[model samples]
Target chain A: MGATIGRSIQCGGHRTLWASQGRSRETRQRAEAEGFEEVTALVDLCAQSDVIVSVCPPHAAAQLAEQVAGTGYGGVYVDANAIPPALAGRIGELIVGAGGGYVDGSIIGPPARASGSTRVYLSGTGAASVAELFDAGAADAVVLDGFFTSASALKMVYAAYTKGSAALLLSVLGGARSLRVDEALRLEWAMSIPELPARSDRLLEYSGRKAWRFEGEMRFISETFESAGLPGGFHSAAAEIYRRLGGQADESFPVAHEQTLTDLLAGAEPAPFDPTR
Target chain B: MGATIGRSIQCGGHRTLWASQGRSRETRQRAEAEGFEEVTALVDLCAQSDVIVSVCPPHAAAQLAEQVAGTGYGGVYVDANAIPPALAGRIGELIVGAGGGYVDGSIIGPPARASGSTRVYLSGTGAASVAELFDAGAADAVVLDGFFTSASALKMVYAAYTKGSAALLLSVLGGARSLRVDEALRLEWAMSIPELPARSDRLLEYSGRKAWRFEGEMRFISETFESAGLPGGFHSAAAEIYRRLGGQADESFPVAHEQTLTDLLAGAEPAPFDPTR
Candidate 1:
């Protein structure tokens, strides 16, 4: 932890390092390799840096916020994860209770040498600077106006749109293939869609592999949608598709850039959910 | 109906006229102009022609065979439509009931300039002459193997696979667009299918217009799946998407082919459910 702090100061590297999941092995290794300091808890991280980010699993988001509630922390704690907004609100409440800043930060894109097809939606008190944070190269984030949970809520909605839809396509197409009507169905799809095949190849491949994440995400949607008094069946069905895809959750997400996806979908492997096979 | 049948011979000009969907006005006029006496209905068409064929709307294929029950019409009744064998059995039952021969025929490939995308799958009963029928160039129909309506069933099954999957993709993509996460969602999709955009474009331009038919077809699927006593929600949902696209259904079903499908789909349009904006 001290070593990472020293590195941050010495090289003006990552100004703040708050690992909400309690310094995962990967985090520890990367922190050590990058010569940055790692704080043990949110209180410690909040005390040390202006930015206290939570980049943990979705389920743990709210719990992490409460961990630092006793401290009179006033710095920004960004919930930078894939959680829905309802969960984000609990975190928001915890941080506000502690006099700390809570920013609903939902990362849709990835940060790497090869940029991923991801985005970050942030709301809550510290949102304005949250968007500026990416500009200063501190992190990749976006802060939009809404409640703390709104961004995450919006994120869940978006994920439902993408992941859930993918599962739907896969199921019907698979049925079609089993019936040996794939070509005619493809034509019918083509006839019906006019140009959807162009966009479909990539999405299908991604959905086939990411069924697990979608499965988990779908649960969140089911809760959110049902709580909002709407039918939760949409998300429930999505959960089925992803959970059944087996280990694709362990597989890396699809590449975001056009060239990479083009190479993949055009190759012999065929797109994931495309039932044209 | 008799007049149309009589005209097919004139339109066809010395060639065997399998008034599959009856005759187009031009075909009818020409057939009559060609001076061959026309016959009415499948029974007469079979008894009089060197070979008999039975073609109907892809959806009513099973029912089309039901039209020929107990006729004792000896010539082969080529079942060329989209359907499944389980349903095809009904057709075979009807043919054998009448002591008439039946052949399973699935048509594949897009029709040549003189044809449509009418490849055939032949199964059961009279496979040889069925093959000969296509060789005889009955509206450019091709033949596959097996019995009765298997070919048509294969067609429907194939349609289910391709179209259903594509429809599924479009629905999800549309949701992504609605969420304003199209970029990120698309990136995710592309990683799985590079050919997605082109496919999507094609769907919008072509299939979106024809998607209306899918709603009715989905009803069939819903029943098919439900008959197995499982949830038929997928088909029902698919039907919803097609219906939601609405207003694209034109009253433009080609006159000659309209009768065959009008009763099946309830309303045959050139393009009934266009989804693209």
Candidate 2:
């Protein structure tokens, strides 16, 4: 997802590099081999690269923002992590405090490699100024144009229902299996009425790949829903389900999650149906 | 809907009449003019008709079962009321005890005329045997040749999730509106997700007409989910929402609801996000 998004800008005549934590020699070597500068220090990367996009963990979003301009970095500090809107606003504050422009860009749908088609939402102070960089060229991101953190707010509200309903369906199916009502009834109800199976399948399919991203996304959604005066717990509950995936080397992320659910539903006995009289 | 469903059955060469209490005499006269029998006496109709299908209030299902059988009605007794599966099981026992060929059937979909097909899942001791009556010729139904009360059980499960999720979404959206965020971020999240709005529309659209049925269904599902070892209170929560809607007559369940949401969001007034949060 990130690679396609990054390449979209690069091929579109923008000096964009596939910058990472340099977590692996593969990514670092690939960045260098691909004719993009791979800098180890934040100062050099921030100075050289026109846009410094950070896709780190949620808690790390603030710290990452703090360091962008502190290390003699002078560019747009694009915080793309799924932190709470409050946190996003705080990150914006930190970016501006560090003499760097802040853009609260929230990516929706899947990232694409093709130019002028990558779906993203950008908002915040100096958001209107960055339009030529993202909205115009290869990557066509829609401007949320709301409040600074509203983009993240939008991401969280959407997640509460999308992921919440998906989580609810799975949980009920577990109950249904326990009641021994047959899986077909669950599938039929899912297909006929609620239609969350497809969404759940998609989440489970992608969570393995985006487990790290989902973790922060889940937390942001939980707090957002809480702030919005709805159930904060649904996102947290989904987070619990995906908490096992990603951000860990041993965790297989989303694909590994598919295995977890399969195994959980396989040998796992459905709780017996016993309506207490 | 029930009147139309009754008329559809009357079309299939059998002598069928509808006996809805308190319906206008003009309506009955219209049915009679249309070459169909319409009466007020349950015993009179039970004696004349070969099949006594009791599609009424949940509390009335068992009463009809007991009263009709006491009239020495030897015809088929089809209790198609949306009652508890266990209650349906007991009603089946009541009809058989009264020397009637009982078929415990539950209609999952809406009532229909001749065009749209409505399913009748059958159960009980003589369930399969009575398929000849409802599923034999023109009556559109899927008679499950299985355990007694399975039809009702399946219906209970479907209602639990459908209604339960509706309640959850409404409650959460209430939370989202009251949240103070970057106005831009909030709108982005709202537009980004579609599940809550889609579902809100459905609930508001049908709540008034469905309030009574939903109350009974909520009772069955609350127990069924509990039987399945899930949190059962969700349906109870849904029942409360509709019950509130019952007082307003012109409330186009969905329209009134959407307006309520709009007013809440438009005011920018702070309200509780999650009820329990």
Candidate 3:
């Protein structure tokens, strides 16, 4: 996703640079194929770039922001990862405190391969400047009129439904399979909601490969919901669902649907009920 | 809904009877309008009917079955409500132990006002007979080839996503509203998922009026998930969401969208997180 974002930036007539000291060989190859200039050190990359976009997994967003801030390189820093608003605000503060412009940003779709397929939402003081970098690219840059964390807030709420509902469906399917009523459930779904069986099929096809990354994102969304004074248990459950499928992240082959159901049910015993929490 | 189901059964050329001793005047009026014959006592109703269909709230299902069982009803008992399979099985046992044939049943979709709008799924030894009662009627009856609780299990899993996702979207909308990013989130949704804004609107319109009943249903779904060794927190959270809106059940008119949002956010403080549960 980061390499594709860099490719979009380069498509907008901007020079994109990456510090690939610890990245995987596949990532290096992808970035190199996208014609990104590679820098050997983080400080060197931070010092040379006018605008830096961070697009990584949710767990790595803050640490990468802190590492970039520690270099004391003043530039527009875009943290475009799925994270809670409070964390996004703190990252913005960390960057701004270190003499750099911070733009709270979030990417909302697949990698920007074509127009209308992806959106880059930006807020904060440096939003317009960062938006300009994607003006001529496939990624649509949307500058929201609100506080800096609005971008991250939107991202959290958006994915809270899409990905959260997918996790709910997977759990439902797993439960039905466990109870030996899966076929009946599918028949009922076909009779009532005709779209769901296909949606569940797509989840089995795609979710396992992305579950590792989504687990962290679900946790972040849980925290986001908690911060907004709603129940966080929905995404917390979603995180558990993704965690069960996390092992399939490195299978190198498509997991069979039945195997995925088995993996989901392997250790998913419910916690004991407590009247007092 | 009970009255509508009675009307559908009557449409199939069967005489529908209800014991209205303690039922409210509104229910009595609805039952009378549906041309259902009213019996003055529970024991009298039990002796006269060949098949007793219990269509009530999830929480009331067991007690209703028990009440009818205490009358020594020997007819086929069909429990058509949203409840966990275990509870349905227990109810079936209670009925069967009382010399009654048990047919585990569940009703999906709205009340049986039209042919295609509702389904009555049945299982167990008496399923065929119960399905025959709804034939040539507005309610389409489907009998599954499995255990008695298969119908209830199908209902549990089906609703685990439909109503559960509605609760999730309500929470997401409430969170966005609380954080003041609702409009921006809607715009992002319009760009990515175009169907969501209208779906969220429909939730605000329809959910509050039915939330009082859905609360127990969500808890039943949570237990259903837990019994299957899956995480129950999704429906637990959904139960909380429904609990907050349960007050709307008695409202004389439709709730405004903004008012519903305010009601949802009211007293929704996050519980303190416990690392160990």
Best by DockQ: 3
* Two-chain DockQ for each candidate model: 0.10, 0.21, 0.46
Runs in model 2 deviating more than 4 A are A9-36, A41-51, A56-76, A93-101, A135-137, A160-219, A231-277, B4-104, B136-139, B145-147, B156-226, B229-249, B252-277
Which of the two candidates, 1 or 2, achieves a greater lDDT against the reference?
2
Clashing pairs in 3: none
lDDT winner: 3
Q: Is candidate 1 or candidate 2 better by DockQ?
A: 2
Candidate 3 per-residue lDDT over residues A5-82, each given as its tens digit: 787788888998989898889988998899999998999999999999998999999999999999996998999999
Considering only chain B, report the TM-score of each candidate against the true chain B: 0.64, 0.77, 0.94
Off by over 4 Å in 3: A252-254, A269-277, B252-254, B270-277
Of 1 and 3, the candidate ahead on TM-score is: 3
Tell me the lDDT of model 3 at B32.
Answer: 84
Write the residue-wise lDDT of candidate 2 on A1-277 in tens digits: 4554555556556776654563677666546654664556666677777677676556677776777757756577777666677777777767777777778876655556454344566676666655556643455666664467655665565555665565556545544454445454644555355555665556555545545556567767767655554445556645644454443434544454336455324434343433222
The CAPRI classification for model 2 reads as incorrect
lDDT score at residue B196, model 2, on the 0-100 scale:
41
TM-score of chain A of 1: 0.68
Candidate 1: C-alpha lDDT: 0.52
Model 1 chain A lDDT-worst window of ten: A268-277
